[model samples]
Target chain A: MTETAVTRPTEIEWHGVSPKYIAVDLIGTAVSALIFTAAATVPYWLIQEPWALIPSAAVLLVHLVVLVLTPRRIRSIRYALRADDLLVRRGIMFTRLVAVPYGRMQLVDVNRGPIARAFGLSELKFVTAAASSNILLPGLPAEEADDLRDRLVALAESRRTGL
Target chain B: MTEPLPPRSDTQRPEEREGLGSPLTEGRGADLAGPLPAGNPRTEGAGFEAQQPQPLQSLATAPLTTSLADGEWHRLHPATPLLRGGIALIAIVGFLITNLRDRFIEGFLPMYRDEDYSGDPVEFLVGEGLLFWALLATLGVVLVVVFFFWLSWRFHTFRITAEIVEVRQGVLMRTNRRARLDRIQGVHIQRPFFARLFGAAKLEIEQAGDDANVQLSYLRGHEADALRRDVLALASGAQRAAAAAAPAAPNGVPGLVEARVQELLAPELDPAEAAAESVVRITPGRLIGSVLLSSGTLSVLAVLAGLGIVSLVTGEPIAVFGALPALLGLGTYLVNRITSGLRYSVAGTRDGLRVGYGLLSTTNDTLPPGRVHSVQLSQGLLWRPFGWWAIRVNRASRSSTNAQQQQTRSLVLPVGTLDDAVRVLELMLPGFDAATVQRAAAAKGGEPDDPFTNSPRRARVLRWFSRRRNGFALLPDVVALRRGWLWRELVLVPLPRVQSVAIRRGPLLRALRLAGVHVHTVAGPISSAIGALDDADAQRFFDEVATGAVRAAGNDSSHRWRSAEAAS
Candidate 1:
């Protein structure tokens, strides 16, 4: 009888992030992981010390687990456009759901990293008066991101309110 | 700080002083060449007015002394030069003269020629018979320093129009900062001990964002209050009314010495000025008791006891001695906390809420309606029996440069009882629901009669002590978060001030079917967050609050409170 997101009949339809986002997340994590391993194992390469391999191997193992979880992480990301706010939900083990009202939005930004742009993906960010309301919705097709940005801008304009 | 300028001119002509003050006239006649840009338009056509046998009373108040909102550039207090950097220059010159007094005596009289020099550069110059050049160089340096101070004072000017308050300053690279009147969060007047000696006060117009605040340092003390009132009046959207009815300087003209003596003797919070007496009376006993009962004091005691136990167990007295420095530091902090709590006052004014504090160097700030973003009332475990609560607020205005000033400014009520707390909240949030706030304050846990949606029993795993007490309520205009069992706390964030709503769940929370909620407001002393709520309730809370926030923001016309009234 316990209520959950799935059981709520009145809950609005939630949209999942693009599947291609998994590649972006994995590639981004792999690049950082490789850099971290290289930095950690520098002593082994410079002094031919065997103990350095322990740290690098441990880092590699962690990265491999993360690589396996990247797809589920992408699938976990969901957003819903309610009547007055844009609701975003993310994270698996540590779940967070944020609702940013259109009126309080100070700035709307659309950015694309090199890899994201290669995959025709863009990340949308919303800036509100409170710095704590750091909301970002990533992994949207470039065209869709642009369209969403324009729609949000218009909505924000119509419902503009002061801080 | 000994009367940096001659007092003769300032004391003689009360009439001329009423126009531009002694400092401005002295600066113009001393060095600056060209005639300044007719800065005082009001004084331009005052020939006939001046000739008439004026009413001394009206002339004393001097409504035209500073037409702040006249849409023209105006210079700051004439003492701005000395207050800014002239004091440093004076100190440097004084130090040089004192250190080289022997050299000077030897060079001039030849009687002390056998005396040993201080081995300074001046000593070497005198020994090498280059005393003339050294004296000339010192004079040159003094002249250059004086010229620069004068130039800076001349360049630093501020202008106030209907919509914006702009200040531009810089001798080389001109810098201009404009704060929109509509965006002004509050106006603060600070009188440091030295500044008060010079009959000056710093007027700061608080604005949002990083480094956005505009400061007009060292304005005439009497004028600072008037200017702040005019600015607040304009910011409240009563520009026309304020321009027509700006309060004339309250007291009639007193001579220079009389005025300074009056200012020095004035109380921290003048009952005459703050028409509505302070809502709470903070007796000396209560102030000291509150400080001693604070959690900080308890921690200090705990550390001391631990040190004593360690010393006894180890049979080493040095253990206690080792903690002396840390204990002294903690003791100093406690003493400071108590001293600063003295002379604190908060009252309601016609324009807004007035809060004044500090003993020697006082600060009086006025926050117009709707400026406060969130309010928090908290009680320590030891304070429970006394029914004491401390109130703090999250406001958009902050002095980013000074962290200490920023912290003290946010605490509207440092300590008070439940009734006093409610009254202070009412001052901040006009027409707030007192009954709901009372219930929120009084509830211990699992109070079915209370309006707040109490956390379910399942949250006990995560918040064993606070499970029943931790909850949130959606009031008519604000979202209230009630938390803590031993240390009770409540936070109220106005619906219009809520920037965003968030719900979070970690692995433990998920297993217990509980979630945490955060109602984002401006960054300040208060944090509007609560944990261990029913998962379903959390979701519903987010949905309803978000929707309510949007509606509240749309309906909010508090920004131009007076303007709305005028329009209707």
Candidate 2:
């Protein structure tokens, strides 16, 4: 896929998420996956249906695969603050790169989950007038997240174009 | 005369004055006369400065603005209560009271409780010779309902000023909605079946936000039309001097009987405002054919046939009943579509595009220039034979519920010939040349000279049949996404309205070294996505569209289309 990487200009500097996000995301994914699997097998606990565990096992397998690729996925999440818009790219098997204009930004939020907080990391989200452009850049140092929010909010205010 | 005008210090240069003044006064000077040039922060402040004194000057000089535009609150039509579901509520209550008189009386008056035996409440009331009492009680209930309706109507007042249209509604929980004239996306007038009988219409002032539309339900039909024109005029930043002189007001709201008679006698099309003839007319035969050939109809037919086959083979008629509800739903949709298609009209008016349709309940949606975010022209498999296409647009105004109804409203042209489709397309994307529209509309791909950068041949593994057809073209003003070999869809998104640009590649696409590109616009029926292009092409498209959108957004003064036209 990188064979034609020349198409992307070399000048733009892309920023990647924190490496520690891999551990936090993997733990979160594993906990949720375990809860779901346990919930799905509740029927087995009640009626002792062996087939219910089959579906539960399948869910566990999917979670295991996700846990294996968590680090790569985290490393792939990158964002760049361009002159007039912010560009965010993530995913390996299913790659997505989105460019959202600063003028259209409706709100910028910085939040940290308990696990991410323990890791001293926060997530920065950008909401635009268009609902589909859901840009959430997760796993930044707390200070960087605050600084980025202030800078982006300032930029948005300056460029406040109507929808 | 008492208020001194701001000094015209910058009036020495006629061009500067023309550029700064309202478009109606500087009609021929549009290019440089747009109220605010994009990217010029100071011009926006200057625009407010320039507009503040114009109305005061108009008041002094003309003072002939319509009574409705006098910057005062106006009550809705007198029968607004009846038109706003009051009759239905009363009827439901009356029916319930008649059916459950015993329970109704017992619930309210325990002294009249009848717990012995309940055969029929109405029968019991009659046997007890309480029918008159019941009737009297019903009359009292009706009076109470009417009182509430009056209260609601009294509280729902709307005011229009030079800068904004404000609607204050609610009996207790007051909700005030103000739509800035500058941000008005469109003005729509809808006359429901019952409302039409009363010769009233609902005027909706659509702005760009969630649930922010200000609706003045049940205005006199003629009043709605006149208000739409006036609101559009003001929103366009046009001087109201000409409109003030226009003789649109009727003497007064006529009585119900006379109004109904007038409605019946009046021509369907308002000759003065809506053009006598639409730019494209969908014939009855064509409309019927399009409905019959629509994918929805075909799918319904398929399900019916499938059910019939299953019943015939399995000897189980119950299977058919399983799909009865689903079939009934689809039938209602088809019926609704056919009726709405009747008497459909799409015409270009001086203000912008005027689209009207309906047999009993009618709607005329006026979209000012540049309000359309994106447009999708699609040809169903059955439609291809007749060269029939439907055009739907993405607009900023989205109703929170009944998304399907909202989508149907977004449909500018339900069904039209290729030529008709082209005409509608040209109207929607004003600045595009006919050649570009035709190229985008008729391009079937595989042509070396086609303007679009098509998917690479290797991408055939993913697209299969649509390998050659799936492509995108980035025009100076719009980006076109062409897809589907059989269904055949072309989505054109104005660069300025593009909220964002995304390039994606799923596992399978990555396996084949292919990518997809999407030009994001406001959420609506139109999908502005193109998939399975050469990875390189996708990357280039992402970069180009990103930069193009930024540049276009920076220069976009389309919000004030009339003034932009004056400047250009």
Candidate that would win on DockQ: 1
In candidate 1, stretches whose alpha carbon ends up further than 4 angstroms from where it belongs are A1-3, A6-10, A42-52, B1-66, B86-133, B268-273, B297-328
Q: How would you encode candidate 2's per-residue C-alpha lDDT over B1-568 as one tens digit per residue? A: 1111111111112223323343222211211122322323223223222222223223322333676655566889989987778578779879977976777678789887646755676668888999999999989988998898888787777767665666656665656555556567888888888888878889998876555577899798887878888888777766656557666666687787987888755655577776447878988889988988888888888888888899999999897896798788877987888888888888887678889888887888999887898998999988887888999998887677667769777999999987888888877788775576576566678786888788888988878888788898888788888899888998899888888889887878877778888887887787888888887888889989998888887777666666654445
Q: Which regions in candidate 2 have their CA more than 4 angstroms from the true location?
A: A1-9, A33-57, B1-64, B86-136, B242-247, B250-259, B265-269, B319-331, B565-568
**Could you give the fnat of all candidates in order?**
0.52, 0.44
Candidate 1 collision pairs:
none
Model 1, B260-339: lDDT tens digits are: 99997777555545668888888878988998999988898888889999999999999789789769978897777777
TM-score of 2: 0.84
- Which ten residues in a row are the worst by lDDT in model 2 chain B? B1-10
Q: Which ten residues in a row have the lowest lDDT in candidate 1 chain B?
A: B1-10
Instruction: Report lDDT (Cα) of residue A154, candidate 1.
Output: 70
* Cα displacement (Å) at residue B363, model 1: 0.6
